[model samples]
Target: MKPTSSLVWLRRDLRVFDHVALHQALQDSAVVHCVFVYDTTILDALPRRDRRVDFIHASIAEVAAELAELGGHLIVRHGDPATEIPALAAELGVGAVYCNHDYEPQALERDATVARTLRDAGRRFLSFKDQVIFEKSEVLSQTGGVFSVFTPYKNAWLKKLDADPSVLAPYHIEPHAARLAPPPSPAPALPTLAELGFEPSNLAELNIPTGMSGAARLFEDFLPRIAQYKDARDFPALKGPSYLSLHFRFGTLSVRHLVRTVRDVMARGAGGEGAPVWLAELIWREFYAMILFHNPHVVGGAFKPAYDAIQWETGPEADELFAAWCEGRTGYPLVDAAMAQLNQTGYMHNRLRMVTACFLIKDLGIDWRRGEAYFALHLNDFDLASNNGGWQWASSSGCDAQPYFRIFNPITQSQKFDASGKFIRRYLPQLKDLSDKEIHAPWLVPRMLPLDYPGPIVMHDEARKLTLERYEMVKKPGPSADQ
Candidate 1:
């Protein structure tokens, strides 16, 4: 009797343990081969110095090395997966191909094409639910309808998880890893960042951990701090968040493992009040993923179609304001500092993401899509679903978004969340000497501002009034709807 051979292809899910498809492949097949393709379909659009590319390169290298030690070779390729995956499967003479599911529209299309090609050659193409605990219609409303609002969805999600804790179980690898197979003949070397047509980025200098070991280190560090997450996450200067989002985005860590550990900690009464709060945040990630899956139109248009009637600023002046907003020269200290953080480090704190997004959409009257595209290009943890959801939320155009009139005041948000301006000062050292109160609104004391720092580009009071007027069109679909 011949043993069944299968190929395990990797996408965002990079780790070898607690992996859905890998474990299933090992269980069903006698021999399993692993591969990671640096998909040219996606990478062709990215810049040469992208930290994301560098981070992924390092991660793939690590996974390949780890797999080799376990008696498997990760056949690395730098081409379109649609071609590379099928070609490799044929080369390895595998009976089936297995991988984790990808939800993005483009990824789905690519997967479909690959599935057809594999089926034509009489091979199985299998994908599994690995990233999210609940996906698609798993946590829908009682009436068998999709959830448009987050709170109700979150409630249902908790109910579903409480009903079945087995959803959080880890997919064991080491026990079955002896079935792993090295590449046929000689193993090809993993591609270097330079070899893949990318320049060396500052990922190492930024001190961002990469791969499985890095994820373990970050999770270990964040466990004790989970107790203070609820209270401390709002302040930018504090070490509050898990800072494991990048790992989540790239699948260096398992969200199921994180949630399970958090739950276990809470059950033992060692997780503190912050554990629940952090768990809620994790559910929010799932909520956004669910939204994107159900409402693909949100990618290009407003989720609430009626909000599309609201006109946005355009022409030369709007371009200037948008440029100013992007460069962190908006003359609002918190907004500017947040932009500076995003520009310099490819990271913007959660509180700051909202503040800066609101300033761009409401205060500057710019389209939220512009800001969304900017973040898509620059953010280290940029996920299509979450990024689109957040931008639309700020613009009051997403499902269950803030009311159109609920404009965020830059100064007030800064005073509330970043009270002492310690975070602002860290990014905008030009305003370091100002009193804590003064730093929140530097233009209030024009004489005190340095010659280099500019005054407020748009006054909050006046902008708020204009924003109200702009949003009035939503109440009555005006001519802007036709445009």
Candidate 2:
């Protein structure tokens, strides 16, 4: 039976078009109302000034404006989603409340509470897979178990896509536009940053785009260079990345749309290696999501339980080192510069993310969780699963992680990727006057040593040895030991 009235609850999937929950609600109801909640449970824990909050606020405004044009008004509420969603659904007398899935543990718990409350009221709470292409146990191994590694999982993902290409099809909502319901009363204004207990961030000055239009603008710019993604993606100085992570994180853009576009380009042989490489990245995201879903313990512990036994640096010295790393005062040009970019823009290049993360775990010998939490607080595109997976990968405590024995040489990495020192110079202007050769390690050039830049925090050679010893403690016993 069709519902006389249904409510569509918008979460990360912020856009109007190609949205599963919205389409589903419109399909089953004569009248559909849209809503977005500023969940204070999540917000109260964050700092007063956050770029993500600003970005979300701006995007919600866009959603409200767009919905108004579509003959519907968005109901913006500020409260715990668990209470707010059920309360709103009851007030609207909705037969069902539709929303997209959220994979995070906290979100799952919150949803469970909302579901119970809605069920008690005799209203249905329905959620659809709208974030990733495949979720939970969707793309399991042949043995019917969740795959831990990425490559095999990626292969399975590709095969599944090949077999069922319809998975990438967009959920067109325009046809059901006539079902949208106007606001019950005057549309409540979106809460201001101050009203929400958050100060204005530099998101506007950074010019990082927001909303569907902003996402489209970025995608249009990225399409031309996607063919070169494989070769250009590694160098931090170049405009290589799609810069759509924020869009993806917030669901301002649809994953299906991106995958479909890339798949079409690959079929035409226009994407070259870049298309497949970029597609693999998208798969990596799903892989992490699957990891988090299957192994929820990864939120607080290592994927390989044995890695938890490895002791990290402690006491005042360790805290001092971590502070240096966070402040961009570590004196390793590449690592420090990467931190500076993250602190200033709330964005860091992919290559730098690896280098910096490796430096934190391998060089500083600090706990990966510390760095992970720091990133969770700062990164505008912070998705818990991906961020946690990345930190674990760098710490050699994750599935398919880099071997602990193979530590990165910070100087060589800087020299190789930022060979011309363009990226370093951009972030670390103190070394701007130095030549490319000298910019990589200013300490090596005695004349440049005493410049504004601090000296190397710790000798790489010594740190590498310390890291090897630390990891050795967790090494399995040799054959002789058993004898």
Candidate 3:
């Protein structure tokens, strides 16, 4: 039986198209009201000048406008969702509340609390998977076990999709658009940044697109370059990436739309190697989500329990080095430049993420969690699962992680990826006078150093040796060692 009224709670899935919860609610109810909460429980922990909050506010405003155009209006609120969602449902006399699934632990707990409260009030709470193509154990191994390794999980994901392409199909919502209800009273105007207790950020100046329209603009631009993604993605200076990660993180764009588009291009034999590589990158995201779902302990500790025994640097000197790394003053051009980019702009190139992570963990011997927390605070595209996975991978404490002995040489990484040092110069203008070769490691240039540019903080060779010795504590026993 159709519910008399339903409320759709917008969380990460911000778009109206291909939206599982919204579609389901519309189909099952005579009238459906859509609402977004600023979610004070989460927001209270954030800074007063966060670009992410600005991005979300802008995106939600766009969504509100779009809904108005569809003969529906969005109800915006600012409070704890656990209390606010139930109160709104009661006020609207909603028989059910619908929303997309949120995989993070805190979200799960929040949902449980809300669900319990709704149940007590005789209203059903429903959630649908809208974020990833595959989630939780949906693409498990043949033995019914969750795959720890990404390659196998991705293979299984592909096979499942091959067996059932319907998974990529969009959830059409327009046909049931008439069911979308206007606000109970006069629609409240979307709140201003000041009202939400935040200041205007550089989000507008950066022009990092927000909302569904912005996502569409980015995807339209990326379509022609999808074929070149593999070649360009690793180089920090190149326009290789889709730059759609922030959209994906916020759910302004549907994962189904992206995967379907890529699949169609690959089927036409037009995307070349880049298509599959790009698809694999998306799969890696789901893989990390699954890892986090199955092993929540990874949030605070190593995936491999043995690695937790390895000691990390924690004294005043280590704190000083960490502060330098955070502030982008570590003096290694590539690492410093990457940190600078992350500090100045919330985005960091993927290759730089790896190099900077390695520099933090392997070079400075700081705890990976500290770096993870830093990224969590600063990255506009931060998802707890992916952020934790990347840090664990860098620290060699994650499943399918880089070997502890395979520490990155940050200078060479910069020289190889940013061969012309264009990216470095863009973020570290002090190195502009240095040639490409010298810019990568300016200390070796033998010229009198610029007063602003600091020398290399730690010699890579010494750091590499120290890292090896440090990781030795967690090394497995060989036959000779046993003898």
Candidate 4:
């Protein structure tokens, strides 16, 4: 007898708790099966020992173990999910496949193929919004056009949440356990790392545990600092920003639950300005996702078409400059420190991200895409939308992005943000001996005697003047004498 079952095709959403798609699947079917595909299309392009891949694998294993405790097992596979999902569904005689929505262009195409396959097999394909609080048209300008800017979009998002109390309600899944299928007769074997052409990575050393257990640790730790986030988030040496970005990226943590808790604190006036500002950053995440949904071209080019025509430095000189930036030898203390942080930890402070990005395009005169690609490759929490949005924002090619002429003065930024040099000392240990004032720009110290420590590679004033000359070719006449 064919079992009337449903399959939850897990993608980014790795956890069963507070998952909308899983709840709906369990409610709509008598028996539910959860599965995750290690999509080869994405994996094949990654390095052999990618931490993100390892993190996902570990998270999925935990999901499988957790589901087994609830009398169901996670069926894991490696290949194109479009073909694999339908095959699993048909083989199990399931009637529907439920999944969380993905906004990336590649994901959209993959989901379409999977949907068609499920339909051909006389099965249903349903996707739920589980990762983000507001997506696509849920928040729009009064003019009926999508908001290209961040502030207005953030304002509209806040208003919508204010209007609808139920929008932040959690999707309870615990009660639907009975609907999950009893463990299969012969449990499917999980593929080993070698089987998937990947090797073990330093995920454990980074202390970024995977799955629900890790998210719990991160959340508990972050709650205490949530109030001080606005004050400390810019300082890379301080533990301010929630380390939960990777968990959020993979949906191990529930977006609705986060918003509800934060919103409640905001209502009670507990989290202070930190709550709203941090919440705005989260909204910015959704805004970038919506931007990609509407204007996919921003992945490769500028969001504003006119900005695309701007010339960028190229050839061997550009290559050398790019190499210097990548190697953390840019001579700018903050920029070098930020690059080191990224290379060592697969993370960069949000402020440093802006600083390094501006330095790359505005100061180094290189194309923004080069830096974007490097971030994409290095950041553990790298989401395509956020990475592209950040690069565009720095280059002034994106809506609501920083203006091109308003370039970041790296030395001034270091002095202001990392005045104590705590962040710089942590990453670039050679500068640890210098005093707070001298640490920001080591070469300027009156009594410099450190033979090993290299001095500033490029003078700030010279670089700034050269950058202005480079940008003048594309920069329009403006009110300020600086432009």
List the candidates' TM-scores in order: 0.96, 0.97, 0.98, 0.95
lDDT of 4 by residue, 23-76 (tens): 888888889988899998888999998989888988898898888888888888
Provide backbone clash counts, one per model. Answer: 0, 0, 0, 0
Ranking 2 against 4 by lDDT, winner: 2
Could you give the candidate ranking by TM-score, starting with the highest? 3, 2, 1, 4
Task: Tell me the lDDT of model 3 at 84.
Answer: 98
Distance (Å) between predicted and true CA of 297, model 2? 0.1
Instruction: Residues 1-483, candidate 2: write the lDDT tens digits.
Output: 667899999999889989999999999999999999999998999989899999999999999888888888889899999999999999989999999999999999999999999999999999999999999999999999889889999999999999999999999988888899976575667788899899999999999999999999999899889999998999999989999999999999999999999998999999978989999999999999999998999998999999999899999999999999999998899999999999999999988898899899989999999999999999999999999999999998998887777677889999989999999988888788889899888888867474578998999889887888888899753221100
Model 2, stretches more than 4 Å misplaced? 448-450, 476-483
Top-TM-score candidate index: 3
Residue runs of model 3 more than 4 Å from their true location after superposition:
477-483
Q: Which stretches of candidate 1 lie over 4 Å from their true place?
A: 1-3, 183-186, 446-448, 476-483
Candidates 1 and 2, the one with greater TM-score: 2
Better of 1 and 4 by TM-score: 1
lDDT per residue (tens digit) for residues 1-483 in model 3: 568899999999988889999999998999999999999998999999999999999999898888888889999899999999999999999999999999999999999999999999999999999999989989999999989888988899999999999998999988998999965465567899999999988998898999999999999998899899999999988899999999989999999989999999999999988999999999999999999999999989899999999889999999999999999988899899999999888999988899999999998999999999999999999999999999999998998998788888887788789989999999889889999788988888897988999987888889877878888878863221100
lDDT of 3 at 24: 96
